[model samples]
Each structure stands twice: as C-alpha cells, then as structure tokens.
Target chain A: MTGPISGPDELSKREQKALESLLFRLADDEFVLAERYTEWQIYAPTLESDLALANIAQDEFGHARLWYDLLGELGYTEPDLIWERPPEQWQHSTLVELSFPDGGWADTIVRGYLYDTAEQLRLEALADSSYLPLADRIEKVLLEERYHRQHAGNWLERLASGEGHDRVVAAVERLFPHAMSLFAPGPHEDNITEFGFRSESLQELRRAWLDTVIPTLDSLSVPAPEPAEVVRPDATGRDGSHTDDWFELYDAFTHTYTELENPTPVRLRGEGA
Target chain B: MIWEVFRQEKKGDYHKHCGNVHAPDREMALMFAEIQHARRMHANSLWVVPQAEIAEVDAEEASFGGTTDKAFRWAMTYNDIDASFAQEVADSEKEQEKAAKTREAQI
Candidate 1:
C-alpha cells in the first residue's frame, strides 16, 4: 500500500479533488441513509426493535460525521457539506434516498441488508486506505457496521419464512436494482484508485457483496433476481442525478434551515461555536 | 453445604464475585456473607447462593463471546464519533474500551 498522504495540506491539487470526491460520496450516502432510517424510529414493530433501529440510525449519522469531519479539515463548512448544498449536487447512491412505503417493514429490512452487506465489504476494502485519516476511522465504522448487518440479517431471516417470505420476495424484486447503485462509480473513480485513497475498486467490492448477499438471501428463499434481468433506475446519484424522492427529502430535511434563514448546522460533538 | 457471595459496592453498580463463605443454608449464608464479604467492603448489597445452584461454564467447555472478532459491540469501535456530546454514551465507551483491552489480554 502507498504511504499515507499525511495531511490535507500535503495533497496535490489533483489529489485534493480526488479526496473530496471520495469523501463526499461516503459522507452523503451515510447522511441520507441515516435520515431514511430515522423515519422508522417510533414506527418499528416492537419497542425493543425501535430502540435498536434508532441507535443504528444514530450510528450512521455518527459515521457520516466522521467523513464530514475529514472534509472539514479540508476547509469545507458544515452547511456547505449538507444543509446549504443543492439537491442536484449530492452524490449518495439512489438506494439510500428512496422513501420506504408506509408499513413497508420488508422494504426497510431488504434495503438495509443489501446496503449493509455492501458497506461491510466496502469498509473492509478501505481498512488500509492510503489516507491516514480515512484508515484511522475505518475500525470504528466497521465495528458499528457489524451491528447494522446483524440487525438487518436478523430481520431478513425472520421475514423470510412462511407468510413473510412473499413480502420479502416482492421487496427484493423492487429494491435489488436500486441497491446496485451502491457500487456505482463517482466522478473521481479513476483518481481514487490511482491515488490509493481506497485499497480496492468498487467493482471488486460489488462482486464480494453479491457473492455474500445473493446466497444468503437465496438460503432464506428471498428471491434476488438475476443481475442482468434487473433494470437500473435512470437516476444514478453518483453522477449528481437523483430521483424526485430525493428532492422531497432534501426539502423536508432543510425545512428548518430555510425558514430559519440558514442557521448554522449544529455540532453536537467535538469543537463548535 | 457451601455458599457463594456476590457483592455490589453501590447503587447501580454490578455485583461481583468477591468471595464465598461456608454456611449451612441460605439464611446462614447471607449472615455469613454480610460479615465475611460485605464487612469493611463498603457494600450497597450482597447476594448469597448455594454453590450447587451455580452452573459452571469454563473456558474449555465454552467461549464467553465467540473467538471471532466482535469489535462492533464496543463503544471504542466508533472512534470518530465523539462521545463527549452525551455523558452516558461516553462513559459506556470508556468502560467498553477497558473491557476490550482486558479481553484482548486474556486471549
């Protein structure tokens, strides 16, 4: 592996852009995914599950903060990183931005399963990232991710039996294609690889993700349609193109920001004004 | 014929296996435990159980947690998430970080 890039100041102009691209992709996906998960907080099937899922959402937001913190070191403000950024500029995968249908427990579990599986593989690949800060933060993210996987896996398995099986199958059919966007490359895909920001390519992580998830779902009799047969949505968020759902989510989350005339994003952890 | 004592030093604190006392029965065990285990220990509580009632699971018979890595359960795993924002989360993480190190040392 290449030696760590040391610090943001040490980065060349090309390297700086490449790092921002990777960080934005990572941060955006986590922030948006956590936002979706919070939607299930009080609505979960049981009180215990509600608490568990809420804690998981908090973990995701914490992870997003980790990536965003790195970006902050590069001189980006919190508002620019999220609240004030235009919806069209977000780089999260489309899968995270989609709203869960009402009472759609199956959809949430399936989406989480697909996403967490990819997340586990992706984080493993970044464990030895050439960027010291990213590498340093990998262990904590991986630790929390392990719980997210177990939580999703438990729900997926529970739903895959008897009557619950059909709903899971339908959810898979509807969501598997969107989940594929988790591996979709961003604008700095080439530079990220060349600069060793990540140790593995997205394609390799995708293959490993599929190898683990497809069979796990199959064993549970949850139908994951063949890769070639699934048609991807036109809005691949990596290219900054997102579905209408995303715009709605952006407006909803930024509601207070807009009405309050863009108050500074609150920093609950670490140093803040 | 034998009694086991567990002592909790304070409210909300965990009861630990301090030491056992030899006694004839549960009542006697409690009395003996109070004098032998709790005396001078600054205990908030004490528990006494028959040695026979406690089931044994040694290292040879079972793994406490799986031998595989389970760093996820520890608060230290989320290194970048500053726990100082919430006192309890930070406290839990600090405790877990210590436990994790102790666990690592044992292995």
Candidate 2:
C-alpha cells in the first residue's frame, strides 16, 4: 500500500508475509500440478500425448522455479522453501495433489483444462501488479501458459466427445470441487490486495474462473455443477492446510532428498552449471 | 500426412530442420514433433510444416550454393588484404575456409 515495494529487502514485516503468501501460492501450485502432470508421462493415452504432458510438466516446473527464485530473494534456501518444508505448509490446491485414477487419461485432460483456464485468468490479473518483480515475471509465465492452455483445450475438446464422453464427465465431477481451491484466499489476501500485489480479489478471480470454465464445459456437452451445488473442501490449501494425498506426495518427492542428508541443491542451468 | 519439424534450442535462435513425423494434421504434427525431434534435444520452440508445402532445390534439381565457381564472393579471394588486422574479416575467412573444406570433402 505504501508505494511500489520493488525489492524484498524494502518490505515491512506484514508486507513480507503478504508477498510470501502470493509467491508460495504461485510456486506451489505450479510445482504440485507439475508433479501430477508427470504422473501421466509414460502412461498418457498415446506416445504424442505422453510427450505433450511431459513438456507441459517441464514448463510448469520451470515456472515454479521462477517464483521460488523470487522467494529465495527473501533469504529462504531451496530446502527451507521446498525439500525440508513441512507437508501441511505447502499451499498448493488439493486438485493438484489428488492422484489420478488408474489409467485415467480423461483425468489429465479435464484437470489441465480447468487449471490452465484459472491460471490464465490469474496471471492476467497479476500482469500489472505494483510489485515490480512479480509483474516482471508475468510475461515469461504467460507465454508458456498459452501453449499449456492450447494443449489442454485441444485434448479437452476431443476427449469430451463420442466414446470418451462419460470418462471426461467422471473426471470433471471428481476434480471440479478441488479446482475451486485455485481461488481460495490465504490469510494474507487482504494484505496482498491492500499492498497492490494483485489487482483482482480472490472472489473476483473465482467468479471469472467459474464463468470461463462452466461455459467451456457446457459447450463440450459436459454439464458443470452450479457453484452452489459444489462443496468446498475443509482444507483451503491457501492457509497451509492440505489433503492426505499432499502428505503422501510430499513424502514421496522429498524421500530421496531427505535420505541424502546433504541437501546441496541440484542446479540444471544458469550460473550454477 | 508427413510434416517436417524444425527445432530452436533457445530464444531468438534460428530453427533448424530436424526430421519428419507422420501426423494427420498440423496439431498432431506438432505433438509428434515434440516427441520425435525435441524429446531428448533441448528446444525453446518447434515448428511443423507440411512436407509437401516445403519447396526444395537439391543437387539433382537446381544446384545448391551454385554449381559454377563464385570464388570472387568468398572472403579468402582477396588474398592481397591482411584479414588478420580485422577480427571480423579474419573470422569470415576462417568460416569460408571451413566451407571450402566441406565442399572439397563432399566432392
């Protein structure tokens, strides 16, 4: 609220908390969704789909790194932010943490469709954020998100028709509730907007998401539930609360890193190479 | 339909022709291209074009890099000038020498 807080060092204690909330939501969503997407890698319906999902997963992981790097500017190491962070402290939505059903190709399509649409809206809202670093990073994330949305939308249309109809519907019905968590406000949401971190309210983003998703699903001949008909999960996921699947996933992913005991962060690119 | 794939390893880089993939449409072609050409290789972007649409001028049809000697166009042709005095001219001569070696090797 007090002018453009350009750097993390300039932030007051409360402003820092607000920024962390936003960054964690952005980073964890991308990281967890990417992990789920990787589950479909070799198991995707076809070889091409496998590659497409793998590429999408990589794109998301890269996006996550971008946000996590921003968090690193606040003095948190990679292990503190991710590897050694407690499972419940991860702020990713339950939708991403939910495991795909056995051989459920339809699950990946519908999940990507719902998530990418919301992601697009969310990023568009963040494009003009007063927080300079946050705004600066939007373009890179948005460019890659375009391909992801296109990939998901293409599959969504094809899979929503003919013999695949029932499965797509089933997946949507199962995942839609958790997708609601995409806009669930964290404890610092008020500070986030008050500090000009994002222009759109979570309620506004949620409405925009619903308006976009429901109509798209309806056009695909998949009946979307009324917002009133859906039940929100007990865990908001924005407040560091999560589903059991999140705990299991956290354990699985961090196991190797933990067992190693020495967490010398692995660097794939940039100056670290 | 067959589509030729081009892979760009980084932003602002030229896309080099990689290989072709069997696909029914442009979308599917791109999907297949990512796997076929970009799976193991690094890619910032990929382009897929219909094989039939790409114009070609091979050695058997119209000679590539020209059949007749165009020695005057090469940087090495001007041997009177000391190209080493200028880094750019020296680099150009080195590139031309490599190209000449490649041409001779082909023959």
Candidate 3:
C-alpha cells in the first residue's frame, strides 16, 4: 500500500491549493474562536467554569498551531500566516468572531455547543484524509474536542432549566443565524473533497451538524431558527469575507505583536506545563 | 482497613497523595476513594493502595541524599553558564531550584 501524503511534494498543484485552503479554514476558525474564548477568562460565572473554558481555549490554540505549522510546511512563515496577514485574508466562519455579550453566559454556551458540534463533524471527516499530515493531527484535536462538546452540552442543559432559561432562549434566537455560517463553503470546497483532503462533503457535514445539534436543542426547548430567516449569504467566511467584528478582533489580538515590533512570536514550545 | 489514596487532578498531571479512606476491599476502596477524594475536587484518575502495603523511611532512620553538600548534582552549580540556549537544561535548572526551596523549607 502507498504511504499517505506526507509532504507538499507529493501533492499536485490543485491538491496543494486545496490543502492550503483547508488548512487556512481550520486554523483560522480555531484561532479566532480561541481568541474570543479567552475573553471569558476571569468573567465566567464560576472559578471551575473559568478554568474549563480557558483550558478549552488553550486546546483550540494548540490545534490552530498544528494547522499553522503544516502551512509552514507549504512555505508560509508564522508571521506571514497570522501576525502580518491582512484581516480580510482570514478564512474563518463569522460565528467564531462575534463578541460575547456582557453577562451573557447563555450566549457562550449556545455558541460553543453549535460551533463545537460542527467542529467535531469536520474533524471526523478529516480523520481518514488522503493528506497524511492533516489526518495525523485530527486525533489529538478530536480527543480534546470531546470535553469541549460535553462541557457545552452540560452547561446548555443545566442553564436551560434555571432562572436564566429566558436568556438562553434569547441567545439561541440571536446566534443561530451566524452559527449557520459554519457550513458556508469556501471556494475550494469541491477541490478539497475531490483531492481526498476531506472525505465528506460540506453539505453532508452540515446535515450531520443539524441532526446532532437541532434535536438536543429542541429537546431543551431551544428552537432552531428557520433556514430562510437566518440565511447569511454574505457570511462566506470561508472565502475571506467576514463581519466588521472580525477585523476589530484581529487588530486587538495583533496589537501586542505590532506594538513590540518583535522579530517573532514567542513559542512556549511545550515547555510550559 | 485503611487505604492510602493518590489523586490526579487532570490528565497528564502527577498522581499526588491526597487523603486516605477506610474500606473493606479493593472495589470498596476505589468507590470510597472516588467519593471521599474525588467528588468535590476535579479528578482525572485515582489510585488506591492499602496502608499496610506502603513502606516509609523517616529522617531519623536514614539521612536522605546522604546529607552531602553535593552541589554538583544541581543545575545551579554552574551559575555562570547560561541555560537559556537549551530548553531541557532550563527546565532542569528550574526544577532543581524548586527542589532546593522545598528542601530549605523542610530544614
């Protein structure tokens, strides 16, 4: 049997572009979501919840780092890929970039549950990818994602039964539209699947995401939005288009790097326990 | 019978001594440990050992590390050399520094 696609050289020109686009999508979504998750650091309702979210954010950043390192293999430096890149060039779903409303713990739970369900499906599809490098990284990410989903799911169920049930419903109503953007395909969607980068189609993933999230949410009395009312056609975050919040978020995150004019971002290099 | 309990707070974390539990057998020991040692605190895994099975040596019985001034074994011995160039060395230095402080506290 032939070995998996280990390096850039093994891919055809189209396959390489497809792989690059896929990596950018994965890395950008994870990095942006993690950046937003950090905003809850000291603000979460409880100490244990705060630590849990922070740990999840760190896991997402680590996953993003793995994807970005692969991009490095394809010739982009870290700065070129992130710190120095224009805000408009990022390819993440707009759902991840939105800010959490103050005291809106419900917002965080709903958003996390929706986003993580989608992420789980996406990772599963990539688990058997023809691109060996991408496939190899999925298991590590998937292991951590298990906790994230359970965390979100548990919080969602508990919060739905409490005095904050109204807030949770409002969060569902407000965030469902943007959550759809997770399934919004980038231009290379077909190329990615055609080249064996992801074995499942985006539509299939979207369908699976719906099947998993909608019923549980419905059971919790959280209504999923009608498809027509929440159609966010402009949220093709996969194609580099994003909401105004993304650029603002991007600038804030890169502010330190730009201010210091540092030669490179500090990498703890797995040394920090 | 008393069971000595070791609790690990999270995956990849060290299994540290917490508290002990009293149970009749291994299964009961584990169940008791789960409630007494792990219920309130976050725990990834737990280990239990019978108090009878554990062996201990007190300071009066033996001098730990031979009470030697063997400063050569510590990374801080060569204070002039920079450990920054290598991560493993830096990590070792930090660990040794922590150990030194603990030993100082004990004394």
Per-residue accuracy of model 3 over A1-273 as CA lDDT, tens digit each: 234687888988888888899999999999999999999989887655676677788888999999999999899988999999999899998888988888888998888998999999999999999899889989988988887787787778778878878999999887888888888777788888887889899889988988887798789887777666775756668878888888889989999999999557767874332
Q: After superposing candidate 2 on the true structure, give the runs of residues whose Cα lies further than 4 Å from its correct spot.
A: B1-17, B22-24, B31-107
Which candidate wins on DockQ? 2
lDDT string, candidate 1, A99-150, tens digits: 9888888888898999989888888877877888889999988977887777
First chain TM-score, candidate 3 = 0.95
Model 3 misplacement above 4 A: A1-3, A270-273, B1-107
* Steric clashes per prediction: 1, 1, 0
What is the C-alpha lDDT profile of model 1 across B1-107, one tens digit per residue?
77788999999999999877665456546655665555335899999888899998899988877988877778885678865689988799999999999999999
- CA lDDT, every model vs. true structure: 0.85, 0.87, 0.85
Candidate 1 Cα misplacement greater than 4 A, ranges:
B1-107
Candidate 1 C-alpha error for residue A23, in Å: 0.8
Tell me each candidate's TM-score. 0.72, 0.78, 0.73
B1-107 per-residue lDDT for model 3 (tens digits): 88899999989999999887766567656755765666446899999999999999999998876776876778875779865689988799999999999999999
Tens digit per residue, CA lDDT, model 2, A210-250: 98888999999998999988988887687878888888888
